[model samples]
Target: METFLSNLSLGFSVALGLQNLGLAFLGCLVGTLIGVLPGVGPVATIAMLLPITFSLDPTGSLIMLAGIYYGAQYGGSTTAILVNIPGEATSVVTAIDGHEMAKKGRAGAALAVAALGSFFAGSVATLVIAALGAPLTRVALMFGATEYFSLMIMGLVLAVVLAGGSVLKAVAMILVGILLSTVGTDLETGDERMTFGLIFLSDGIDFAVLAMGIFGVAEIMRNLAQPESRDVVRKPIGRLLPNREELRQSWAPVLRGTLMGSILGILPGNGAVLAPFASYAMEKKLAKDPSRFGKGAIEGVAGPESANNAGAQTSFIPLLTLGIPGNAVMALMVGAMTIQGIIPGPQVMTGNPSLFWGMIASMWVGNLMLLVINLPMVGLWVRLLKVPYRLMFPAILAFCCIGIYSINSLPTDVMLIGLFGLVGYLLIKCGFEPAPLLLGFVLGKLMEENMRRALILSRGSLSTFITEPISAGLLIVSAVLLVAAIIPNVRKGRDEMFVE
Candidate 1:
């Protein structure tokens, strides 16, 4: 307890500094704007901004980035509530009831509830992160190469299980990602392996370039292709505050969602993506009038928004502690850290305590900033939504091109965005998600490195993986999970759950 308090105190000292506070505020502002722009998610925004962070201090830059992440959770609800356009995937459930509320002239109240609920969840999740950080890092520190390899295998298995749609497709995307990760020089031998005699290929694909292409440019393309009409609420937003009955109904669901989201967010395989959906399902099941769920039930909006925000904040745990990204957004964060010369892992806490805890503490502050910025600025956000998609698409594409080009002044990087943009579009068309591919790509190099080290230590003995207790246990669990996920009944149930 004493140590936790001491560390938290240290976090506040760093996060509350003038410069760091300003960065947090700026991040929140930018994050909210991007979130309001439908289809421009935090992944693309952060990828675009990575080059800018090169000049900033690591701690401040990370604090700002963390702010953007959770801030988007708050901002994503605005479009969902006012226009039925779900700015982020996490807001899809929010749109069910939120848009209904907007249609019924309760837009203001719904927006307020979402922002406040997100704030409460973010605050709670921050505390959870601080509490879990040291212990999780200690656990991570004990992992040897064999254990780490097995753990990563478990993570990929979890990814396959949790991934929506066909298991086979997800596995194929993951394999492709692993293959992409190998398209560079071998670390030990310093020999180019998969370069195909191209100089650009020799250095491997740039994470930011791939991310910008897959998410940024591709998102622009997808959004441009979609029908542009939106049923934006133009009437006077009713009272911004929830009524007594609404508040009364919301508090319990908010609490439940925060707890559920916090727990799920800690799980591997982008569990945060499941948080809002799970909360919605639970809320519907628990409601006396389940029929009200899709008809503007305040609890639906409040619960899922809270869950989304909480999950976004808590998903940082794996990235901070175990040096593994649980989702695509965190994978971008890993790229950011690597670009900044910080090798992520348990050592981050002991080696860069300020950066670690400060980022955690800044989340609470960022949430507060979002709450303050979102409510009064609701009018601005709604007005911004009136902008034409045609204008937005070109600007986004140009900005992405500029950002990609600036990375190394390589025209090849810009061209790669075009290539990957097509790839991303095809992935969507083929019913495969781009996120799992990105995660696999991020984890591939680490997995291969650890597997090699573990094999070397074992003198080419394949049984060593089973002989090590931790590795054996992890592999067993992973095998069980994979088998369960593949079972006909289990797979059907899983598919149904995600479909909801």
Candidate 2:
């Protein structure tokens, strides 16, 4: 208790410093702007801005970058609510009932609930990190290759559950993503597997390129094909504050979502991405009238938005505590830390206590800043939705192209975006979901690496994964989940639960 309070005191002192606070505020502002603009995610934004961090102190730079991450979560809900377009994967669940609420003339109310719920979640998650971060890091250090491999297996199975429709389709998409992940040279052997004489293929496809292509460019193409009337929301913006009954209904889901997100965010392999989806599933299950889902259910907006924000904040745990990147964004953050001459892992907490704690403290501050920025600016975002699709799409495309090209200054990357844009369009046309593919792509490389390491350590024995207790338990759960998903009666019941 003494150590916790002392560390927090040091954190507040550093985070409250004039320069760090200013940087945090600036990052929040910029992150919110990018989040409002579809296809321009925090990954691209942070990568673009990484060069600027070279000039600032390491602690301040990280504080700013961290601010951007959670701020984008807040801003993403705005676009999802007002425009029916989710700016980030985390906000995709938010778009379901959020847009429905907009159509029902409760756009302002939905946006307000999202922002407030996010603030509440962020505050609680920040505390979780502060109190449990070091101990969690200790726990993470105990994980070996076998344990990690099994954990990845579990994560992949959960990804399949995230799909709203056919589980078979989701599994196929994930397998395709794993195949795509294998395109680069074999890391251990240095032999190219799928390069096919193309040097760009040797390095594997960039996540930003793939994400921008599928989510951003593909979305643009789809919107362009739709009629203008179908794209715009014609409903009046209703009251910003929810009624007493609405608030009463939402608070429970918000609390539940915060707990769910905070716990999931600590796992490896981008577990945070699953939080909103899981929260949505839970809210749907618990609701008295499950039929209201996807049609202006305030709980849908409140729960997922809160979960999204909490997950985004806590996803930092693995990066800060163990030097492991849980997702693409954290992978970029690893690069940022490396460039700043700060080594990640347990030593960071011991060696630079202020830097570690300050970053954690800034998360709470950033969330507060987002609430201040988003509530009043809700009107501005709604007006952006009023912009015609023709104009908005061009801007989205331009920004995507710029963000992709800026990664390596290569036109090949932009071309790849175009290629994947077409692929994404076709997949959607065929009724396949893109989110599962992304999850697979993100985890595939890590799973392969861990599996190889575990096998090597066990002298090529596959049983090593099941021999370890933690690994065994996780794998067993995954097996049970797979079986349940496959069983006809269980599958039918699961399908019925999600029916809208």
Candidate 3:
């Protein structure tokens, strides 16, 4: 206890420094703006900011980056609620009811719920990180390659549960995502899997390109194809904050979502993405008016919005404590640490308390900073809904192209993005959801690596995956989830979970 207290004190001292505080504010501000912008997610934003972290104190840099991450998520719910366009895949569940509320001219109520819920979640998740950091790292360290493989398998199956369309179509899209992931050079044999002899295929498709093409460019194509007469009601957006009645209905959801988000956020692979959806599903199951879920339940916005923020905040646990990045933003963090000559791993706390604790303290401060920036800026965000599509699309597309090209500096990436844009459009036309495909692609590379590593470690013995304790546990849970996802009776109730 003494040791922990001493470290916490030191962390607080460093984090409260004026420079660190300012950076935290900067990150939150930048993050919110980007989050409100369509297609430019925290991952791409963090990647773009990687070069800028080189000169700062580790505490300040990490705090700012983490701020960007959670802040973007906060802003994401706004767009999801107001415009029906999810700021990122994580906000899809939020859009289900949030946008419905907006359509009903309760955009202000939805925004208030999303923002406040996120703030509460961010606060609780920060505490969760502080309390559970060591134990979670201990749990994570027990996972070997075989266990990781099983975990990835579980995540892939869960992706299907969240697909939200035809099951067959969702599975097909997942397969396509996996195949796309295989386009890069094979690690074991140094041979291409599906590169089609194209030089761009050597590195596979960057997630940014795939995501941008599918969501950003394809969305543009879609809007242009449809007649402009469809958009009739501009959300009236009466008030900026929720009334007392809404506050009463929301507190429980915020708490539940925060707890769920913190736990799920720390899981490897697509856990952070799953946090919001899981929270939304849980909220509906627990709601008094379950039928209001799709139509316009404030709890729907509150829970998922809180979950996404908490998940975003807590995702740093693995990256900071274990050197295992759960997502792209965490990966960039690892890179930033590496650039600073600080190797991130179990020993980081022992070797660099200032960095570790300062980072942790900065997260709490950053979350607070996000609330300050986001609440007042809600008006500015709503104004964005009035921007002309022609200007917005070009700007969004340009940012997407730049982000994709910077990953490998290849023109072929642009072409692949265009191709995926077309594919995404077709998928949209066919009523297939794009999120599960993105999730599948997100897990694909790691899934392949873990599978190969496990096989190699076990000398190609498949039984080793089940024979091990951690691996067996994950596989068993996966089996249970798959069964639940597939069973006909259960499917009728949670049908939203079992499709494309």
Top-TM-score structure, candidate number: 1
1-500: candidate 2 lDDT, tens digit per residue: 99888888899999999999999999998888778866567865675566566678999999998888888888888888777778777999999999999888988889889999999999999999898888966776688888877866776776665455677887898898888888888989999988898998898887667766776677677767766542446777788889998899899999999999998887654567789999999999999999999989999999999998888888888778766566657756765776687866666887898999999998888888999999888767666656666766666577777767766889999898899889988898889977667667766776798899999999999999888999999899989977776686566879999994
Better of 2 and 3 by lDDT: 2
Q: What would the TM-score be for candidate 3 when compared with the true structure?
A: 0.72
Q: Tell me the TM-score of each prediction against the true structure.
A: 0.96, 0.75, 0.72
Q: Over the stretch 248-365, how does candidate 3's per-residue lDDT look in tens digits?
A: 9899999999888888888755678899989989999998779988998889988888888888878888666656566656656665675566766656776777878887877777
- Which 10-residue window in model 2 sums to the lowest lDDT? 223-232
Using lDDT as the yardstick, the better of models 1 and 3 is: 1
Please give the lDDT score at residue 329 for candidate 3.
Answer: 65
Name the best candidate (by lDDT): 1
- Give the Cα error of residue 238 in candidate 3, in Å: 7.0
lDDT tens digits by residue: candidate 1, 396-444? 7888888788879999999999999989988888899998888888888
Residue pairs in collision within model 1: none
Clashing pairs in 2: none
Clashing pairs in 3: 161-497, 163-500, 164-499, 165-499, 165-500
Clashes of each: 0, 0, 5
Q: Over the full model, what C-alpha lDDT does candidate 3 score relative to the true structure?
A: 0.75
